[model samples]
Target: MQTYPIPMVPGPVVVPEAIRQVYLEPYGSGDLEVEFVELVTRTQRRLKAIFGTRDDIVIQSGEGMLVLWSALKSCLVPGDRVLAVATGVFGYGIGEMAQSIGAEVKTLGFSYDETINDMARIEAAIAEFKPRMITAVHCETPSGTLNPLEELGRLKHAYRVPLFYVDTVAGAGGVPVLADDWHIDLCLGGSQKCLSAPPDISFLSVSPKAWEIIDAVGYVGYDALKPFQHAVENRYFPYTPSWQGVAALYAAAGLLLDEGLENSFNRHDAVARFCRRRLVEMGIDLFPAPGAVPSPTVTAARIPQGFTWEAWDRRLRAEGLVVAGSYGPLAGKVFRLGHMGSQADKELVTQALEVIAATLK
Candidate 1:
């Protein structure tokens, strides 16, 4: 059997050995049905706690993009205006999804090296477009920029925008995101990122106001959130749910809670600081401009002037370390180092940096 390299990529992070054991157990049978239901219930509650929201939460059987698409489909109808804030690849992706669903999409873009920190510009766009819904990515993983979502959330409330959708897929566990405090109507996250679980499971939290809008739209399908709503309300699986994924996520959540959310955030903060310090000591430049808030979960740095990411990345992998490269405008300019969940440990960060320094040399 081939052993996987230490996963330091931005997502599908290294799962804890204890959590991986959950996968070895057989799927729930008739005798274990109630136990499985309780597990799901506990997972949902813990997810809401992690999100810092009391809103209805759903665990879906797909990647984070599924929850993002479901939010757009459930709330937006033809002719509705959507003002999407694009700071990086995933931010631009929100506008693309909105447009694909036939909503009139307007984007407020920022340079890949900066975050959308200007509330004035976002507010101006909202005023000019009069959008029914607004989308923002809390952390643009590609750029390693963390947008000011609290201010934007407050802005949305001030504008009386019916819905505020946020992609916190890369932010939630590593940083602080109070969905209720920020007035975020719809917030989505994935088990793969920061949560330290395997891929194929995503979760979302929906506020009552957003639920009202979703109900009015009345869309129903495999991708719709309606079935998830029914599942939550009726306490049953909407379809054949992924019990293994749920269990894994549940175990991960328990670990986070046991560690304490504040401590986890602090740990991520320390890891990010350590990584940046090491990079600077090596005479490397970070991707985000000065004054731009970097993501606590990942760090994006420019590749050395003469070294291409393809060759450097391959070299690092040969040394048994795995990092990520950028996409979109940053494809060749930058590479990403993820410091979240299990990979956020000091030993991992130090080892990855050692591999990086050697590869670059």
Candidate 2:
């Protein structure tokens, strides 16, 4: 496989040597190894701190979508009402996933270039729909926008919503995801994005309310969260666990904690701001709507007028610079530059931007 010299894609970021080194050595079986369970617990502790939650953290062996499906299936039964608040691709797609599982979903959608800020409209939806769950995406990577969850959380609490699910996959480590304060029941996360690890592990913070729903629903499948709920205590897992993936996750989470999450947030914020400023200086138009808040993890900019997305992407690739293209409606019109995890370095971003500048010339 040809690895791009510059990795500015949205996920599966270039893993640092510190995180990758653990995979080089051999480890014991995840099912029998007491240390593996300890590793899982320890990683969960670190993730809880990062997520700003006291809720139980469930780690599984798969990519980010694994836990996303797990959370929805575990907590909801067929015909359950789900109010999916959509601002972009992932936000809207998650709703479709719910529908696939037989959920009677009402998608409260917004423009692709915007974030979820219309709380009054959302509250009215919640009031009328009386959904069992309210789902949202904290950072919509495709559009490079961040939705403020504090107000939404307050609404969730005030309305007595049974569950509030959020996918903070792209923003968990580099951004603030206060699960407890936000009254989020299932705060979904991934290893690849801001966690600075390979894309093999998935995790989520499960609140007491979410656990209750999981128990009640009794969902059984490969993606079910129930098995994980007691796996540690029982010294077992649903399937053979990958010690390498868990170990990598442990190291990655530790790195974030050591740096202090606030510092990570500041670094990502500074880098993203700089990235946007430079893009604007180069006469590039950003994709986020005027009122939408841009994410600290990724920047989505309009493809320069003359070049088709295919040609622009090919040019960037020829220069050994690889960023991501937008999905859904924004496809072929917007490109995303990820600056999260190990790729969040300012120097790295500068180099990538230089390549972009040269390509656009």
Candidate 3:
């Protein structure tokens, strides 16, 4: 394997040295408790700010997918129906999770490269199925497409039957996520994306409406905490939490807040635009559609014909750049460059594009 001078691929983007300094502090002391609790609480608040919601946040001990499954199993019952506005892999997965939890899943699946066109179909399905929840991925990373979340939220509200559950795993920090204004019920995000932290930490914000629904049902065995009463034990995971991931997540949230939410979104938006502009200047075609509909957190491009995907991957890797290949059906046909985390800067993105141009020769 040849090695280039630059390290490519998004995340595990170079962790900042200052954030790493948190682990240097002593642990398991009374002081540690104060620091840890404050850190977690503050991070939750910062997440609320980014989500633009009064919804309560839960810092779960696993990947965003785990938290996502938790929401499905907790809110839905055996006979309840769920409507999923699916455009890509993650959106499909949300529908599957609802199905696994015994809910009847009804998906309005769109082509991989396109956004969900049939909001009317979604509304019609809700009316036909009378579903209790609507699951959606705010940005479908697999296709690099952004769904119309505000409109979807509005539709769910109008239907008055199903609540909206948003998976903002890729879109939270980089895109505008107005959970309150949009009337989103449950929203989830991960630390590894725009927060520029490690992958283990993920968060979920539950609105008052969600609580009412869940309270009417029962408890979610995984990470259920009692909000109103002191007698109920807040059941966290059966094991100790990831201290390092938590500390890094808190520090990353602090960094994100310091940067400010709007600034963070604009930073990612600008980088994504730069990438698209450079691609167009190079005479390379993007996946399709307007840049606005594409995910601001990632860019997916068609691999040039006649060149094998593996050859291009090897060429880029030899130059120390590591972009992602498309999944499943998209494999070999499309390549993805993540703009989240530390790669959310123009310098890094330009360096990546430079590597690609050179590799093409």
Candidate 4:
């Protein structure tokens, strides 16, 4: 039997065989304009449902980091204050990006092992910093931790913060996102993650308040939201978009909607539980503490005492399973098991775990 490498990484997950057909379709036909418009429109509607936002949803032609940067760049000018809440590597990276944009960035950082659920500290930072924008990552994939975005969103509203941003790249389909109800002014996601698509497109949902700020600032070039807004209003793209990626995402969104968002999230939860249980049975300790909220998209576990991450990772790859290694403070000490998108299934997860069990024994 012919075998392929199984990707258990967080993003750019395994694409469903059905969606792969989208790539084989021809591009640049006479119907390209009409077909692309319909694809974009349908994808935007499905994205709104997934993010739970009634606001503007823009699909950008780049990785998730591009949308993250665009969201921050559009809203913030030099000297604007931003309060970034960091629980893991990706959460901290948001703050770094803000700083690069010349925003006055202050991070309220928690330990890697802890979820960002400390409301008291967050409140103190909000009161002291009086930031124009607040940023957080809903699912910190590297540490397998989930932040309390609902509580953070409530705090943002209570304080009347002008802009509130959430990076849900790893959380979008696998977890619940109440963007409108929770007062998330800007929410970002990537197709490569829980959407189960290739890694070429990122998306953002923009609220009216955030749009007003963006319009006033008037950013330019590829990083600007104005061009995307123009494209949306006129039903044309700002620049040449990756039609292949667009088609693939359209098909992927169909798969997600057909399965229903709630059902998809429930499947992720069940798969995560199964993965965690199997890891425990294999005598591996999970990274996040018992009380902390762990991410349903991925599971972070401590590497076995006798083996290094490099050694174990090599072994897993040799067995045709490609898991992820940790970053930041946990580099080489922790390994991650991704159960997102199409990979969040009992059969696939069981196969990967069986490999781990055999290799470790």
Candidate 5:
């Protein structure tokens, strides 16, 4: 087998010792694996600590997309309009999912290079459309922009019309997301990005407000189809969970908690800032707007006119470094470096930048 130097790909970067220990533990469906239940509990508890939410949490056995699709199906009703703020590929996927379930979807969007629609604009759209649900992505990884969660929360509370659902798949644990404080009804997260876990588990923390609305609507009679409480109660998924994947998620969750949320966030922020600084110093231009909110987990840079992103990417790989290609509108024009997962720290970022600098020269 050929040995590779360093992997800077977006996910599955590296797993911590504590996380590895949890993965190595044996499994059983009996009382011996009762500790496995603890894994689930601890994962949720740690999430609550980070999200600052006491709301009900559900750990699903799939990627972030699974949770996103499930939440829309379970909550959104036929003919109900959903206000989707599109900024990237995943944002568009949310609208498509809502429409598949008979939702009258209306998108309030911007170009991939642009940031989110302003809160004032969102408020006006809400008043005009009177949508029953609002979907927003906290961090648009493809563009490296952070949406204003607090502002969105305030607008939702004021309108009191729609349920606010946030997709924080790349933002959670790395950025500040106060689910309870923001009064967001639904929030989804993934383990692979910021949590540094194997890519198998996704989680959602459902607010009481959402539960109340769900209970009042009272079973539309299709309990089997719902994703929130449905899959959990049934235990077998709509299909079987990756048992080993769950173990990995639990281990990763434990490691995140041990480092502590504040510390984790600070470390990520430092690395991102360092990366941005180095890129600018290397005469590279960032894609995101200056003075605007930026994603702490990923940084996107526009390739210089004479240099194609692929050429630079290939050169970096030859020097034993790896990064990601942009998605959708950004493809071929920009390259992204993820400052999340186990490698989301100063040491990893510094080394990665060093390799990039050598490649550029």
Candidate 6:
């Protein structure tokens, strides 16, 4: 496999050596050790801090999508109603995932380059649709967009929606995701995006109301959340745990907290601003539509006018810089520079931008 000096992808980013080393050290069996359970408990506590919620945190062994599916299945039975607010690939995709599970879904979609800025329209849907659950993505990574949820939280309560779900897989540590304050019942996040950890761990902050619905649904599967409720306290997990994975997650969360969440947010914001300014100075067009909030974790730009994505990607790779291409409707038309977690450093972004400039010239 080839590696690049300037490594910037949306996720599964270059894991720092501090986190990489945890995988090498030896430990007792995950299923038998009490110490492992303690590690999970501590990790859960640390994640609660990151999520800014007093709710219980469930740390499961898998990449982010595992919990996304689990959360929907655990809470919804066939014929349940879901209102999915969408702005990009992941946003619209979540709505389809719900439909696949036999739920009746209504997708409130914006352009791929847009965001969920029209809350009045969303509120009307909630008032009329009165769905059982409302789903949204906090950061639409593919489009480099961020949707404000505070008002939706207000709508969730005002309309008495039973479950308000969100996927903050790309924004949690890079930006603010106030789960409790926003009244989000099932707030989903991953280890890879801003935590600088391996993509082996996934977590969610489950509110009491969501848990109640989960219990009543009685869904049982590998991704099920019910077994996890007391799995930690009883020293028996749903499956064999990954002690190294959990420890790396624990360490990763600590790294962000040590830096201070607000400080981290500011760093990501500054770097994003710098990246966009440099791109504009080079005459490159950004992808986010007018009025859409660009994500601090990533910057999406249109492919150079005369260059196809394939050619542009090859040129950058030849220069030893790596970035990501967009998905769905954005494929080939847009590209991204992920500046979150360890890669959020301003110097790193400057270097990445330099490569883009040189390639453009």
Query: 84-182 in candidate 4: lDDT tens per residue?
Result: 999889888999999998999999998888887769989989988999999999999899988878888888999999999999999998899989988
State how far residue 194 of model 1 sits from its true place (Å). 0.9
lDDT of 4: 0.89
Q: Report the lDDT tens digits of candidate 2 across residue range 1-361.
A: 8888888998989888999899998785556989889989999899999999999999989999998899999988889999999999998999999999999999999998888877899989988998999999999999999988898888889989999999999989999889999999999999999988999999999999888899999988888888888999999899998899999999999999999999999999999999999999999999998989999999999999999999999999999899999888899999999999888899999999999888878
TM-score winner between candidates 4 and 5: 4
Q: All candidates' lDDT scores?
A: 0.88, 0.92, 0.76, 0.89, 0.76, 0.93
Count clashing residue pairs per candidate. 0, 0, 0, 0, 0, 0
lDDT of 3 at 21: 85
TM-score of each: 0.96, 0.98, 0.90, 0.96, 0.90, 0.99
- Model 5, C-alpha of 294: deviation from truth (Å): 1.3
Which ten contiguous residues of candidate 4 have the minimum total lDDT? Answer: 29-38
Judged by lDDT against the true structure, how good is candidate 2? Answer: 0.92
How many angstroms is residue 59 displaced in model 2 relative to the true structure, after the best TM-score fit?
Answer: 0.3
lDDT of 6 at 232: 81
Off by over 4 Å in 6: none
Clashes of 2: 0
Model 1: lDDT equals: 0.88
RMSD after Cα superposition, model 6: 0.8
Model 6: weakest 10-residue lDDT segment is: 28-37
User: What digit string (tens of lDDT, one per residue) describes model 5 on residues 216-326?
Assistant: 554343221234455433333444455566777766766777788888889888888898999999988899876567778888888766778778777887887788878
